[model samples]
Target: MTAHSRDTPQFYLTAPSPCPYLKGQFERKVFTHLVGENAAHLNDLLTHGGFRRSQTIAYRPACESCRACVSVRVRVDDFVWTKAFRRNRAINADLVGADVGANPTSEQYSLFRAYLDHRHSDGGMADMTVLDYASMVEDSHVRTRLTEYRRRGPDTAINGRGAGPLHAVALVDRLSDGLSLVYSFYDPEQRDRGLGTHVILDHVQRAKALGLPYLYLGYWVSGSNKMDYKRRFRPQEHLSPIGWTLLND
Candidate 1:
C-alpha cells in the first residue's frame, strides 16, 4: 500500500440524503477535513476545484445521478449592473460594512437567530443555538472575516465601524483569487431594502477594491426558488466537468 503524508487530505463520501435544493431527489457529497498547517492552502485548492467550506470541512456535491448544484463565481471586472441592481444599491446606501475579525458576538447571534426564525424556519440550521452559530463562525482554520453591516452614522468613518443596529452580516474567507462568501444573513423585515442583494453587491465592490477577480457565491441550483436570486449576478462562470465556463444569459 502506498503511504500518504499526514498533510494529504483523505476524502470521504456521505450517504445519500434528501436533497436540500431539489425535491424528490437524493444528494451525496465528497468531503475532506481542512485542518493542520496546510488547511488554508487545501481550502483554496478545493474552493477552486468547486468545493465549499463549512466550519473546517470542504465539500462538493457528488450525487450519483443528479448534477443540479453548479458552482458559480462572479467575474468582478466584467459584472454588468442593471437598473434593478442600481435601485437596490440606492436603497441600501445607508448601510456600512465593517470588515471585522471572526469573533462571534451576542449581537451577531441575536441577528442570526432573528434571521433564521424569519427566513429559514424549516431549514437545516433553524435550530442552531448560539454556541452552534459561534462554532460556525469561529471554528475555521482558514482566513475568515465577518463583515458586519449597519446603518451609517456620524462616527462610522472615524471609527471604521458602523453604528446603530446591525442590518446584515456576511461570513467570508479571503482567498488568493477571490472572496468566498461562506454565509450571510440580514434583518428579514427589511426585505424591501434588498439587504441580500446589497450584500453581494457590496462584496463585488469589496473584491474589486482588494484586487480580487472573482466573488464566489457558493452553489446555484436550478429550479430552486431559494437559489433563484443568484441568477441576477451576471457574467458569472459556472463550474462544469470541462471547467469554469462563462454564463452570459
Candidate 2:
C-alpha cells in the first residue's frame, strides 16, 4: 500500500447538477479540500491549474461534454485603463476600501442578503442564512482577507480607511502570485455607483502596487451575460489547454 499522508490532497467529483450559466445543460466539479499546513501552497498550485477556492475547498469544472468555463486572470501590469474605467474610478472616488481579517459581521451579512435578494434571488446562495454566510467567510484555511468599502472619512488622507455605512465587501485570498477575488457583494440599491466594477478596478491597482502579476477573477463563461463584464478588462489572460493566452480584444 502506498504511504499517503493525510495532507496529501485527494480530489473528488460532484454529481451533475443543472447548469447555472447555460440552459439545458448540467455541471459537474472536481474538488479537493484545502486544509492543513500545505493548504496555502496547494491553493497557489491549484489556482494556476484553473481551480477556484470556496471556503476550504478548491474546485474546477469537470463537465463531460461542455468546456464553457474558462479561468481568467487580469494582467495587472498591463491592464488597460479606458475612459469608462477612469469614469468608474471617479464615481467611486468617495469610497475607500480597508482590508481586515476574514471575519464575518452582521453589517456584511445585511449587504450580502440584499445583494442576493436583488441580484440572485434564484441562485444557489439566495437562501444562505447568517451561519452559512459566516462559514463561507470564516471557514477558509488559506490566507483570506475581507475588504470593506465605505465612504471616505475626515482622516481618510492620513488613515486611508473608510467610514460611514458599508457600501461593498470583497472576500479575497492572498496567493503567492496574486490576489484571488473569492466573492464580493454590494448594496443593490446603489446601482449607479458601479460598485462591482470599482471593486475589480481597485483590486487591479492593489495587485499592481503589491507587485503581483495577476488578479485572478475566477471562471468566465462565454456567452453568459452575467460574465460579459469580465471581458471588458482587456489585456487579460485566459487559461487554455495550451496554457495562459492573452486576450487583447
Candidate 3:
C-alpha cells in the first residue's frame, strides 16, 4: 500500500478548556497527528480545510457554541502595500533574513525564552524549557524551515548574511500553495521596528517570488484584541463552510 493509504490519520478532540482568546468561554480542538512519509501531504490538505499545525499535530478550534476562529490567507498578487506597511518595511530594512533548516540552537533558545518572558509571560508557552523549545522546532515530520533575521554586517554584500545578535526568528512550514507561519518571535525591546508586521510582509514577498498564491496567517479570532492585526492584511480569504471566500471587511 502507498504511504497515504497505509497510514490514514484519525482525528481526536481535546477536553474543553478555558478559552485563551475570550474570557469566560471554553474552547475545544479537533486534531490529528501528522507523521510518516505522507505527513506533508496531509498537512497541506488539513491546512486548506482550516487546521493549524503545532509540531506533529494538526488542529482547529471546535467550540460547542462559538465560531470565533476563522482561518485566513493572504492573496499575494492582490496584496498592495498601504502607506503604513511601506513605513514598517522601511523601518526594518536594515535587517536581513536567512532561511535555514530546522535545527535547534542555544542562541535560539535564549531568544525564545526572553521573548516569552517579555511578551507572553502569562500564556501557555511561557514556561517551556529548552527541550520543549527544541521539540517545537525539530519534532516536525513534514517540511519545516527557520528564518533568522539580523542586522546586516559590512561584509553582507559578499557573504549574504548578517552579523551581531539575532533580532528575529520565524518558524515556518512549506506548504504546496504557500508558506505557513507557525510561530515567530523577536527582540521585544525593538518593538519600535514593527518586526511582527515586517515579518508577514516579507513572507508575502517571498510567496510571490516563489509563485505561491497565499501566505497562511493561521486563525483570526474575532473580538480577540491580539488577533485584530491579522485582519489588516486585505484582499484576503476566509475559509468558510462552502469554500475559501474573499473576506470583504
How many residue-pair clashes does candidate 3 contain?
0
Off by over 4 Å in 1: 1-4
Model 1 scores a C-alpha lDDT of 0.94
Output the TM-score of candidate 3.
0.96
Write the number of the candidate with greater TM-score, choosing between 1 and 3.
1
| Models ranked on TM-score | 2, 1, 3
What C-alpha lDDT do the candidate models reach, one value each? 0.94, 0.94, 0.93
Segments in model 3 whose C-alpha atoms lie over 4 Å from true places: 1-6
Q: What overall lDDT, based on C-alpha atoms, would model 2 receive against the true structure?
A: 0.94
Pairs that collide in candidate 2 are none
Candidate 3, residue 93: CA error in Å? 0.7
- How far out, in Å, is residue 216 in model 1? 0.2
Q: Which digits, one per residue and each the tens of the lDDT, describe model 2 over residues 170-204? A: 99999988999999999999999999999999999
lDDT-based ranking, best first? 2, 1, 3
Comparing 2 with 3 on lDDT, the higher-scoring candidate is: 2
Instruction: Score candidate 2 by TM-score against the native.
Output: 0.97
lDDT tens digits by residue: candidate 3, 1-249: 545544699899999999999998999999999988899999999999999999999999999989999999999999979999999999989999888689888898899999999999999999899999999999999999998898999988987788889888999999999999999998899979988898899999998999999999999999899999998998899999998999875
